[model samples]
Target: MKKFNYQELVDSEQALQKRSIFWDPAIYEEELKQIFNRCWLFLGHESQLPQPGDFIRTYMGEDDVIVVRGKDKVIRAFLNACTHRGNKVCQAEGGNTRSFTCSYHGWSFNTEGELAGVPLEKEIYDNLPRERFGLVPVARLDSYKGLLFGCFSESAPSLIDYLGDIAWYIDVVTDSAQGGLEVVGAPYKTEIPGNWKLPVENAIGDGYHVAWAHAGAMSVVGAIGNGRSDNVLGINANNTGVDQSGAIEIVMNTHTVLTTLDGQSGYALYDHPEPVLAHLERNRPNVIEKLGELRGRQLYGSETHIGVFPNVQIIQGLNFIRIIHPKGPGKFEVWTYAMCERGMPDATKEIIHDHVRQTFGPAGLLEGDDGDFVEAITHSAAGYATRQMQGFLGMGMGRKAPWDGPGEASPGLVNEACQRGFYNQWRRTMEADNAYGVIGQTAPVTPVTAVLKEFRHG
Candidate 1:
């Protein structure tokens, strides 16, 4: 096993990332231990297991975990491995079950992960104590605005502290809803032939690719091509006054009426369409007020997007949360959840779901475009010369500054703020000795933010 000098590889501000970080098995192993084990990773949402006996199986890196709602109504998570002879405890993805039975042996565990039964305990090992062999539970678990996260390291900071300033951004979207956001259903799971970090980095705020990489999709949607839509090059452009290249506006107006939509707020509004409005109208004014008219309109009519760090990417306008799980240095398993508000009308939900399926799922058009680029980039790094060459992230390097506005804004769709912010944070996390150190560092800008600020006050 190759040991890496974590500090040397990641501490400097301008140092380019070593290509081996993406393709080396030994480095990946260290990431699993140093990063995944210590940092709070997003588990499935609370809605996935709302009732007792309901459970969903998910991954924390490569380790399998069962997220369950206990009889006490509290949520809990446990390793899927059976304590008796080490067999997998659950085979299916998610469902309501009284107990999980290990197929190899008849050992059973309840919703709370307590060892409930052992088939023929008297016959096996002269009656081994059931209390001594319950399923292993994760060290820490917490939720922020309905999104649950877990960590194998007990010393990790609370989920709120870990989220830090990013929580403010998340709240702009999640808390915008009256009842808060919920996952639509099970994730649309699939695999991609690229490193896991590629997709995560892309969605962390890579707006530069939307016009070029997803040009075909944009053209089909009746919007002008990103570059052709407007004759602006690099970061600065018109529209919102943020750097043009870094900001790609999706559905800013409803029938020519301009309305800016925040990611989570848009989700709540869209999830509950006309039918939900009627339902609310029948109730009371307070209920209707909770679902504000403009917010509701934006929800049903606007877009949703997210900048969740490390590995989750959500596009509310696109209606999916893409989770990238690293299978190996060169392989990734991409899981997408087609989400909407819980009480949304069936017709509206279906429309959003179908739209998401067509745009970003396993066989979707836009997904195909991005997958090609990710794989090609990973492959190109194989050449010694190519690996030595530094990739460009200076599209709007020193451009952004603090904005005194309702939300962070930027200009064009080609800025590098998002990608830069992601890498900056990634470098910090990888270099830190623990999660606390990672969260304590200064806030970094996504490429869009950097460029917009630069132009505003450069």
Candidate 2:
């Protein structure tokens, strides 16, 4: 693949050349090399593989992988391809298994990915060195707060370093619950007829579209997405009836966070029961003392929308985490997981599940709107005239200002600052010769310091 200068495609902080990058197969091919192949992609959470031999089928880019808990109680991942004939070795999504045997040739591999049994062994051909034919493991694997992430490139930075300041913000949910978080049920998986990047941009706190695209669904969930909020982004208090102003829009590295400062608790949107509210309320002082006044207040109320660069998007108020996988230039799949406090009652979990399903799953009322919108964008780009034009993203340009806050603080939820940040990082990664080179280099336009690095918000 030719090394396309992503900087030229991105133009500047305020503008982006949309058509060539969004719909071109050539661009996607290069992205597979520079971005997907080099980054630390999230695989499965530790909670998903609780016991020895438990495993789950997941993807890193388009490559199928089997993540398993070994007999030694260590987690590992291997390419799900047989050493012979390139046949898929595992088909099931997840279950406990002592070994995975290729259905085609009957070659078996143990949980540690060592070649165990071969159909012919010493009979058909001189017993080949079995040790040399074990399942091919990924280059590197690591975890942060129980979230498993694997990197195909050995040169990639450490998982925590790659996460950067975004880790500090994500811990609000990952570290908040008493026993940490877990995937409650099977993921809601489905294909979206749109470029994978579109969804990533949306989840990076795309407050601009929520009020318009999901206006109807917002009414059903709560008044949160209605225009009653103090800002155009409709990020007011959960009880939308009350009038309040002030919203926090923060862009850190490739991550984006949107929070409403309206005094009402974010729990109101979920209709959270009093006990749920009290639990967080009881622990509020600790988080407050840890994160200081502003961030602590924001963390206390579940009123933030966050997206960790490349793929993972989390909505604290909605209690949902989604991982976007690129299937092709114009198609992608989203794996949705419902999250709740570990010790919550069954009834409470059920309620949380229902809410998450109704709001963000494949058939989710609000999610349906976003799918249609992004798909429309993809379809429109097919026309020759549309493909020749450049797209505008100058929302709140020249408005970003350094604040004493945690990340790159900016005002106005409707701004495209996060989109710029996303493309900027994309350019950096694509420009680098290797993944480790991506460290210490963000959008060149600004310098990032974790001012609150020592603050343990949760």
Candidate 3:
């Protein structure tokens, strides 16, 4: 937990992170304390629990929690553990329930998390105080456009502030349409023997991996990864026969956006692009009028791969929201949910869900295409000498963000700008004493220091 360990673990000037960060148990424990506990970790979308008594079990860094809709119509979360003997109060992933009863002792808690009933109460105790035994609540719970996030630290800033200017980009998908986004079907869950940060970095717009790693899926999916936004990352667009002219790649702090500018829609890989394209075209004018021409017209159907710092990610067009849950230093769970505009036809929703499953689910086509290295890098670090080496994120260094978004925006998806931003925030979080030291201290984040926060000149 020493400051020097963090400094060495992530040396930005060298544009590298120690291989050990993906393997060490001790460093993982520190991350739970410094990063997971304080940040506003996404829990579940409100659409998942609509009725009173509806609940779903999810996790916040390894801490299991129950997110329920109260009879009073408010959403809240509490530790899944019963206050009695620490046994889980509920086991079902989700369902409508009058109350959660501990399977072992029969202690029960109501939706608001009050200790509503205790079996054999009169005989078991001499006036035991029921209120003292309620399910322990998460420190802070809040929502942003129906997405739920919970924080264990009381001093953390409001959810909107934590999102920063990233909200504007998020609005392209969430707020642009008449009705905001919602999870369409039950989330697809799978466990990967990979470090949590690996996936986080990948989704932080690792557009570089899309071409080589997912080559098999490329041809079938219209080669969307063939550098369509701005000419194959550096390779000429003409070489691939995919015209990249007029398409714009918008880089935001910790995110990468690709707009198939001038009426071109983004989800090229879907089975029937006509349905998706029609939907986008139908809504184009309305969104443009609401969110402005630049954000609405360009991004409404654009391919937006956004990683909301730490671990939540959203793919706007193919449309799935991902929550990367940390199981341990070398293992994590991928919870994938399809996101679609609430106003869309049920058939369109079905299309988005099917495509999300085929592309990003556990046994997905592209999953195999890109997962080998993710598994390899983590397990490789078990070797002592191997773990000592540092990994670099130096691609696209020294590039200034000509456009205003947030954080430093490097030019293309091939750039490791988001990865560097990921580690810089990780470094600042590990080095800070509390939540206030990192997020919300500033608005829209004053761009990183003159030389990238971690990429120091001296």
The predicted structure with the larger lDDT, 1 or 3, is: 3
Best by TM-score, which number? 3
lDDT of each: 0.63, 0.74, 0.76
For candidate 1, report its TM-score: 0.79
> After aligning candidate 2 to the native by TM-score, how far in Å is the CA of 173 from where it should be?
1.5
> RMSD in Å for candidate 1, one decimal?
9.8
For candidate 2, lDDT tens digit of each residue in 171-196?
Answer: 77776655678786569998989989
- Per-residue lDDT tens digits of candidate 1, residues 342-418? 65566756766776777677777667788888887777777777765555566655454333323334433455556
Compared with the true structure, what per-residue lDDT tens digits does model 3 show for residues 171-204? 8877865577788547888888889999888876
Identify the leading candidate in terms of lDDT. 3
Q: Report how far residue 298 has shifted in candidate 2, in Å.
A: 1.9
TM-score-based ranking, best first? 3, 2, 1
